[model samples]
Target: MSDTKSAVGYTRLSQTSDASIPDQKREIRNLADREGFALLNIYDDGQRSSGFDAERPEYLEMQAELETGEVDVLVVRDRDRLSRDKRERSMFYYDLDEWDVELWTTTDGRVEFTDDESWLIEMIRNYMDDVTKRREIQKAKKKVQERVDNGYWQGRPPFGFRLDSDKRYLEPDPGKFDTALTVLQMRENGATWSEIEDETGVSAGTISRILDNEERYLSHVE
Candidate 1:
């Protein structure tokens, strides 16, 4: 972020989360100001996911621009803002070399990045990113189980019955719920799994799962 450096801020937001985008931009802007960097452009990919499997539109666009030698630095909120994948993380390492653009990141209120000893810095960054992503996944899985154990619906809310509600509780849809009940009844009535699946238009696997769900069967009885 030296005065000699010119930068562009690259930001991405998940498709459903624009609520915090303003704060993200503000954080980047403040950093640019404090660091005395002449910001070249603000490249924003709204409603885009930056996970490893997907390449964000604005991110790709910025890459094209960088390849043309447009930016000297790329700034973001954190390592995860770019990616959570170790392989995708390597893209940054190489891309910076190709474009001669330094990656600048601020996490926990401090600006960090590579320097003369950049490879060493990148190695540590790569390690920390992997650790962070692993812990995040584990935490998400545990939260799902915790919600299920607390008698709340677990995992992402399925279609129907207020899917967007913040609360974890399930409100069984009348149509699907009835189908669910019949599937369970058929199972207990000694119907073949495939027979129940055909009757309910539910996937055979889904039918088997609903039939096996102790909570759903108890509620079906109630």
Candidate 2:
């Protein structure tokens, strides 16, 4: 084991992360055992988004270890576990290259810095991850809009409103609706935004927006 490569595994699960972490770890372990790599440790970022600016504590720790030359190879369940953004994946790839650490994945296979085709394949894998995430996001947004059109709230209910018992539509809050209506009436009576804010305790910006979107708010009032 001492003469073999000191390898560390990294796994991340964002969307399907709950059921996939164990599976990822098992695959990495099996690979290490079969390939005779000296498995040093496994790092995981559970439920952490693979976004460009996400705070991945375990991933950062792994990078620090890589910098210190503790690991000769890095293993992951997939390239998306490292990053879904091309810029971030490229940055991580170069950093690992600088540290002379190889990358092994269950999905895209092993990548050594000296292997030119390996780098191209890794890039293609990361690019595909980004494309998949974008498509998922677009589909989610379309579904949300469809729900909104059907009079269902896509997210949390606004102030002075609550989600109905079925958790689909926004319903007027018995305690807060009167105040909201009074605020709206004041705005209708030529009250300034600041005046509405002072009377209703809602922010001036919010009050202005509520007044501006007449069809959305007034429809509820009627």
Candidate 3:
């Protein structure tokens, strides 16, 4: 085992990010200095989630180098920065162990492969991270369902509707309601989507959807 080795840092900022990539990199750099490792390169996965996505471009590139025994040290701000999934994290650890590469972290310092406590701590953290992601996703789905039940559009409004003044609910566009109705009536009278589009100047896709008024319209309203 070498006393000093070439190191590369990996960092991630999620899609719903708070611009923490710089802070993560700074911590990794500090760790490199404290450990006397040569900080050779840094990789970032910006606006990407470690929980949902299996592939991150820069992270994979780093893994390729790690596989070839090029990076003697792999540093991260935290273990979850590598992956929220325990399986992926284990795969990375396996590769590092196979290559005799050392793992370093700003939070945990240098890892000792024989330390069972360190391994358990990592497993717990990864489990917690995954749980948090699942909870967040469930919460978001519930919120969207609530909005839909309350007659508020959860996402962008259709062509014949616009957001209310508060932007919390979709209201029928007074200017476009008649056009939507016309499309529906024409379709009912055996008009093709393109024919309806040509007649009403609305796109064929929107016209097709408008024909399914229940999907794109609020009940008890035009």
The residue-level lDDT of candidate 2 at 167 comes to: 84
lDDT of 1 by residue, 87-161 (tens): 777766687786777777655443344455756676677778778868976997898788788877655544223
Please list all clashing residue pairs in model 1, or write none if there are none.
none
Off by more than 4 A, model 2: 17-19, 115-117, 155-167, 170-222
Q: Per-residue error at 120 for model 1, in Å?
A: 1.8
TM-score of each: 0.59, 0.65, 0.67
Q: Which has the higher lDDT value, candidate number 1 or candidate number 2?
A: 2
Best-fitting candidate, scored by TM-score: 3
Better of 2 and 3 by TM-score: 3
Q: What ranking of all candidate models by TM-score puts the best one first?
A: 3, 2, 1
Please give the CA lDDT of all the candidate structures.
0.69, 0.80, 0.79
Estimate the overall C-alpha local distance difference test score of candidate 2.
0.80
Local accuracy of candidate 2 as per-residue lDDT tens digits, 55-153: 688888889999998788898877677887887988899999999998888766787657778688767877887888889888989998998898887
Error of 3 at 211 (Å): 14
Q: Could you tell which candidate, 1 or 3, scores higher by TM-score?
A: 3
